[model samples]
Target: MQVKKCSLIALAISAAVSQMAVASQQSEAKGFVEGSKLKVLNRNMYMNRDFKHGQRNGTKSYGEEWAHGLITTYSSGFTQGTVGFGVDAFGLVGIKLDSGDGRNGVGTGLLEINDAGEAKDDQALAGAAAKLQISNTVLKYGNQMVSLPVLAISDSRLLPESVTGGLVTSNEIEGLTLNAGHFTALSNRNQSSRDSAGMKSLDLAGGTYKFSKDLIGSAYWAETEDYFRKYYGNLNYSMPLSDTQAFIVDFNMYDTKSDGLGLSRAWDGEKLDNQIYSLAAAFKTGAHTFTLSHQRVTGDGGYVYGPDGNSTMYTAHSMQVSDFNQENEKSWAARYDLNMAAFGVPGLTFMTRYIKGTDFNTTLSSNGKEWERDVEAKYVLQDGPAKDLSFRVRWGTRRTADIATGNMEDLRVFVEYPLNIL
Candidate 1:
């Protein structure tokens, strides 16, 4: 049955491509063929996670792995007409370079594991989408990656998650954009097969309106079939204090409630009702930006979303290790960012943040407390032979007071080179 489903998807994509080719010949597709773009990104990723205390399940005390990936993307422009047509596709390939006995687990999320508790050596995943445009409104169908306030694709590992669905977007009014979609299944970052069991169906709609030059407002809602419903709202404002100084404020909120059978009720054997909110303020002076933020989660459950392990929270402290989203949790963070352009070095940047959370509802301790420190350094080549090449290093440490064996240190090194094929 799975093979049949895969074959059907492949056939559908092939049919779409064939129809696009035929349309290009009939319509003067100069824009479609000439304006197309292709690019391939070569990525090398290495990750290490060291447990400060003894590991759980007697598996291993540390996890480490290295992988290389090639991601190729092709985007074609619409044909010239009142109603245009186009197509887009992406191909991903991941090769495991090193996954020793202690590192070949699902925790890394870089490779898939088999029944024998061994990670796959290599894997490939691909997807394609067909699109139609009429004026400022566009429609897309088939497999694709989507990013919205309530639903976002995860790209934290060798490959990003992709979903099979149809979406409609429009920007008919100036400074306003609207989006709506229905997705049936998703292929996670580590798996090559699309699975509908995780989230049977997802329906989402949202809009963003730019109130002014420095202020924007957004609202979104999403419903997962037989699971839950989620609503999100955001507000952003910025003001220039002087020629070299500015201040910005951002506020975000989320409301979640169970629906239908409430599948997530398995977590606590009760209906899920949660509210999460965050507020952040930033002050920028020349090359330095300082930020302070606060976030809180209330009610019986924590923030709920897909199971992709990537956060869609619009907060300051959602780092690589923890989201600080425990039930009845309140967290605060202070962050600093430095731009190297001010110090005569371009395309280099550094960021560090510390977050602390308390007032949890865990079994270990009712007033559990945890803290995390995250640091990142990145550089990108601007010009010359290696233009657009980028390198990044990320490190994070989490310490917990009430939870046993929960302290961990994470480090990752990522390098990428993108080549334009067209």
Candidate 2:
């Protein structure tokens, strides 16, 4: 790693502080039993992936799957004391709804597959974490979901991923938050057993600071044993022009380098050094939002993540079907979002985005190119029987000149309902 990459972590730790008053959270703590709560979510999802190239080079022609998932969680509030303690637990169950022998390929992340290439009928996972709190800082240990810029758990599939680890979070200062954690094992979304991903160890530290109501900044660093070290930084600012109009600018960047073990484990037996960054601007007026962004990747390899989480990449162009993260790649994107409530149709929203990448280096061609287009619609019940229930549909089409990726169309449908049963 470059010496300059250390600046990100330093900047986060040395951020300037303002004269904002921070209240003592421990002083208002409630008893554990009094603050305990339980909740459950029912999720039904169906996904289809159609390869336009169709089984070329021995790949699957298409992939499709449907599954129903039930997730239950319980969280106990801190006890009333100088030092408080609590416990959190989660249970997940995924049942295969519709998946044929040939349709349940690796592309469908909905269910587990056996050695005979058949999808499992059902899978279950359970985990728990114990937490202690003092002042405005908390320490948690055991299995849990971690969400940070460098290391995060992926929850895009039927069930959310989890890691066995210890995490410390501090909010002692107003408008500033700090986090640190070390994880030893990971459980994937489709598996029932723990440590399915077989991660050796991971260490992460990061912090986010709100400079003001309109501006915020974050920095993070992470290291995966035998893999690589990653450093990330972000700045986001919102400029309000009036009550109904505003402009936003967001920037994100990452620097990555491989370790000795990583070099040995590389598929092509090559070292890895990469830098990726993105800048985005958005304008919002009334119920509509327009966004434009540019992203670039440079160095010896593309952005690499996973065994950490699929959602670890926080770049602007990491879209539904493609990340546009090939080595020496430059991508541009345009997006629009609409809220139907402004048109007398409450609880409905729509989004569409297009991204194009060029000047990428690939083994097949030095000047590789790709593009993706995505559209999504979602609606939630406004009131009455299904008040919080939601339905969402997403479609994405991707075309690429890279030999590794075939042209494809992807579709996903989701129905979700949450129940509070404390």
Candidate 3:
């Protein structure tokens, strides 16, 4: 980060000023034009371990990745002060110049490519986003990652996860935010394209989602040509018991029958209803914060809602939970964090947590169990030219059988720095 900060400043002055000024002028004339709002960002990541398919799970002792991402944004200025019409566009590109097939456990950062049913290496994935709106409500359409607990955009790897479709969000109300969308496709980082083999459209239908003080709700229905009619809804609430503590509760339910034209299921291959309920409490004060969250899965199969196959929703460890490989499970998490600045150490922090799931009834076993533990720390340059630059180092270990097949015992060290340009 020290080197990067120095280099960026050296590269920013007199070096590209003329080129940038010309581009800025062109953008002002052509609103929503491509490559207008350009940014240079890089995430340098390191991992100590890789995946394990049991005996084949672990990999090289250590691995590293340096990814440079270029992003460009576009938008029109508000029209004459009153009600305005504007459009926004986003372009993202990720380039990976390191790692080989042997060291490719989990830190490769780049998705795989297929050649004659074989594997090939790739260097990048490109994604774009566009949105139009008036007032405080803007409707975004195209391919970009959307973030929400009920409909989150994933950032589990070198590049952020993305999807295809339209999303609308409104924040005109004080202390209230409303969200809704209908997606027809998803662009996972690893996949080659949006039209890959495993991707499914599921007779896509629109849905409405709203969130407000102490209240959260969503209603959505999707009809896949080959499967059942999937309807999903969720409700969540949180209130502060004091100045430093928050109590949270969430309920999620989904119903799936048949599409009336197809048979069989993908992923879990089970035809049934799925539901999950979660309760959590979080406390934050001074330099330290602690959180406790518990989740329960009921009905048959796992759960489904929105465009993700990730765990239930609204949890940090959902990326580790999936499928019927381990069923009817009860899981909980305990996390602790610290801010070094409170102790006169600026830009330094620590985080650690443990998550475990057990109690199962699946084809693999009538009884199964699994657990995961993670620890992480970070530091940022608090002063000087790199005042806002940050670096994060994370380490995680998972011990499971017939459950969670990726990242045996993983450690990731990554960094991100943002620059403000007007």
Give each model a TM-score.
0.90, 0.93, 0.73
Q: Positional deviation of 365 in candidate 3, in angstroms? A: 1.5
- For residues 1-422, what per-residue lDDT tens digits would candidate 2 score against the true structure? 22332443333323311111234566577879888999999999999988765643366768899999999999998998777899999999999999995788647677888778888889899999999877777778998988888887888888999889878777777898988777888898888778887688888888999999999999998888778889999999999999989999999999988864783222245667889999999999999999999999987788877568778888899888899888889999999999999999899999999999998877777888999999999999999988989999999999986746548888999999999988
Superposed model 3: Cα runs more than 4 Å off = 1-38, 52-67, 71-83, 105-109, 114-122, 125-130, 172-175, 196-268, 304-312, 316-325, 404-407
Tens-digit per-residue lDDT, 261-328, candidate 3 = 43534235666555555555666676778878777666666554433422225533453323222336
Q: After superposition, how far is residue 222 of candidate 3 from its true place, in Å?
A: 5.5
RMSD of each: 6.3, 4.0, 11.4
Q: Name the TM-score of candidate 2.
A: 0.93
Give model 3's clash tally: 7
How does residue 131 of candidate 1 score in lDDT?
A: 86
- Give the top-scoring candidate (TM-score): 2
Per-residue lDDT for 272 in model 1? Answer: 81
